[model samples]
Target: MKLNSAQLGKHLQGKLAAVYAVSGDDPLLCQEAADTIRSSARSQGFSERQVFHCDASFDWSLLYEAGASLSLFAEQRLIELRIPGGKPGDKGSSALIDYLARPAEDTLLLISLPKLDGSAQKTKWAKALIDNADAVFVQIWPVETAQLPHWISQRLAQTGLSASQDAVELIADRVEGNLLAAAQEIEKIKLLADGTPIDADYVLACVADSARFDVFGLIEACLNGDAVHALRMLDGLRGEGVEPLFLCAMLARELRLLSGLALQISQGTTPDRAFAAARPPVWDKRKPPLHKALQRHSAGRFNHFLLELQQVDAQVKGQAAGDPWSSLARLCLQLAGQRLLLEA
Candidate 1:
């Protein structure tokens, strides 16, 4: 059966499937699903599990060998095959097709992939897995601007602490919809709330740590149209081990927030009100830069920049070649300017 990350906890309650295939773009959610299956398999008396990584030169026979192997403890065995590249290409595809035709009974099989594309999802190998195993796809699309508040509420719920509705909305505005970043901030709230409900102050204190003296600061400087400071901040962030892609993701989030706010402005929402209505209030320090961004970038231009950042994000994740950090730096520089190339 197919299940989403949110549904896994309840779905795995009593079901014990022998074969599972989890594929997705969200690392945290995808890993959680895989971990759930592995944990369930262990509790179901699968005492031994062999793991294999599939690369360009991986042999089909290795899968068969693992399948044929028995547990020394006289229990059902589990075989976990991780294909980080997602699509296994022609040879691996053929091997998987053949294996699925008559899978092993004594050994439970689980297949994991980093993320699968639409074309790969329609392939015969993927189809066979869906037919024979419990297949799951975890898609992490960007959340809608209006729905961000509800998203923050649900995320905060995961940590057994709830934020006031206004507080949640405030936080959402502060961090926007970058789930990973939002998650990080929420975790901080859980740590500091000390059983009290999280509020706006709790969020501001922990939401923008990197902003203090790094790339975030640079981005803020750029937002405020201070090119010199932005450049310095970028260098500092790079020196501190924050990956180029990570900075790209954060900047993209900021730009996206600006775009959304700009849209609201076009509809006659005042800047002060926009900041107030933000799921999370914009940091007092960040306000200067963000205000400059609003002044500098038209809504359409900001949207273009945001899309470019998304593509940069994909490239940095190895979806495309070339130097990701260099590519990211160029994009940042362009955004720091008044406009950016729509395509890179």
Candidate 2:
């Protein structure tokens, strides 16, 4: 049966399913759900544990062997299978289907995977796992901006610390869209709280800017024409020791995407149609900013930025005699519609 992270606790309290599939893009939620299952399994006499990470060269037969082999240590066993890329090839698909046909007795299977899209959900193997009566499928969703404050408040309450509304709001703003960071911040607050009710002032003083700021956020800000915020985030990332090469790589990637989308639009495709056809499939939340960037910059302009990014890449590797960070800042400003006197 399908369940959410919140419902998994109550569901586990009753009876443990033979197979538990926990999937989500949110690392914190997925890890927590897996931890809950592990704890539950241990309490039910699952003492032997085996973990397998499915990578490109993984042997699918080992999964079967793990299930078939009797544990030398304990009667009940917990087998953890993690698929980082969320796609099991033809062999894996067949193996999984065959194994789930009749899961071994006294063995609890826990599969962890990244979020599967619609196409993946329709696969034969995924269908078998989800439709199987003995399996419990739990999908954890990322907390949206609107729900983050309440999520933070709930997490704080769990730690025996009550926070004022302002404090919760402050924490939410600092860690928006990054639940892992939010959890860590909550732990930090718990240590600093000393049983005192958390206030905005205390949070402001103790909590660092642990918000999920990545190269993607920088790209979104630039695309949306928010130069100030984009530059501020750039500085914040730089201060946090983000590498210039990584920054250049992200800038180049976005420039390539914008160029491709612009080319499609120039060839008589509508922005909406072009966006849908773009590789990696730009998410709905990102469509607005991407559309804005495409409208503001032509294909040729994006190509020009791509060339500039190449130069920045060389400077980052110390092969070119220029300031990579300065060039990055200039490129960001230009992308955000500012006219800057940047050297070639």
Candidate 3:
């Protein structure tokens, strides 16, 4: 049966299901849920654990073989299958469906994956796992921006520490939506607090701004037409030693997604529908910025920028004689709505 993350703890109190499927984008919550299951399995005499990392080169037959094989070290075994990319092609789909039809005796199957979009949820294989009688499906969602401060306050209280309202807001602003960082910051505060409530001054003094600026965030800034913030974040990433080639590849990927979505929208598809139809589908939290970016440029304009990105790629690899950083800054400016000549 399907369950939310909060209900997972109580569900595990009774008899455990033979298969548990955990899917979500919140890394911290996902890991915690998986850990809870693992701990319960160990307590229930699941002594042997086998881990498989699924990727493009993964062998599907091994999964079948593992299920058929008996464990020599322990009576009960746990098999962990991690799919980093979240798309299990035809072979994987068939294998999963078959395994779920009749799971191995004395074995528990745990599948961890990224959050599946609506289209993925409707897939036959996904449906089999979620609808199966012998499986438990738990989906974890990220905390919204508006609720983060309260979440932080709750987490602090769990650690036997009280934080002032301003302190909670300060900590929340620094961590952004990264819960792992938020947890770590809470622990740091707990250690620094000496029988006193955490105040804004203490948070400012103890907690450094750990906000990470990823390529996706940079794209959002550019899409929102905040050239100064985008450039500042770019400089911050560069100062933190983020590779120019990686930055170029990330920007190019975003542009390509926008190009595809824009083409579909131009052909009379709604932005929401186009986003859902796009490959590696656009996430819901990111759709607003993506739609904004689409509005700022046409399909042809995005195509042109893709070509410019190629030159930046060549320059980064030393195939061309130009400063890649300068070119990247120019590309960032252009993406932020500045009309500039593509550097030669």
Candidate 2: tens digits of C-alpha lDDT, residues 229-286:
7898898889889999889878888899899999999999998888889888777668
Q: For model 2, what is the alpha-carbon lDDT of residue 122?
A: 92
User: Relative to the unseen true structure, what is the C-alpha lDDT of residue 311 in candidate 1, on a scale of 0 to 100?
Assistant: 75
Better of 2 and 3 by TM-score: 2
What is candidate 3's lDDT per residue for 1-344, written digit by digit as tens?
Answer: 99998899999999999999899999999999999999999999998999999998889898999999989999999999999899888999999999999999999999999999898999999999999999999998889989999999999989999888999999988887889999999998888788866899989998977887777778788988889878877887888899998988898888888899999999999998998898877778788778777888999989988898899889988899898888888888888888765443
Tell me the number of clashing residue pairs for each predicted model. 11, 0, 0
Error of 1 at 100 (Å): 1.4
TM-score of 2: 0.86
Which ranges in model 1 have alpha carbons more than 4 Å from their true place?
133-148, 170-178, 208-344
lDDT of 1 by residue, 25-143 (tens): 66655666788888988887888878989888888789877766666875688888889888788888888888787787767788887656566778998877766654444343345
Each candidate's root-mean-square deviation in Å?
13.3, 3.7, 4.7
- Arranged by TM-score with the best first, the candidates are 2, 3, 1
Clash count, candidate 3 = 0
The TM-scores, one per candidate, come to 0.59, 0.86, 0.79
Q: For candidate 2, give the lDDT of residue 103.
A: 96
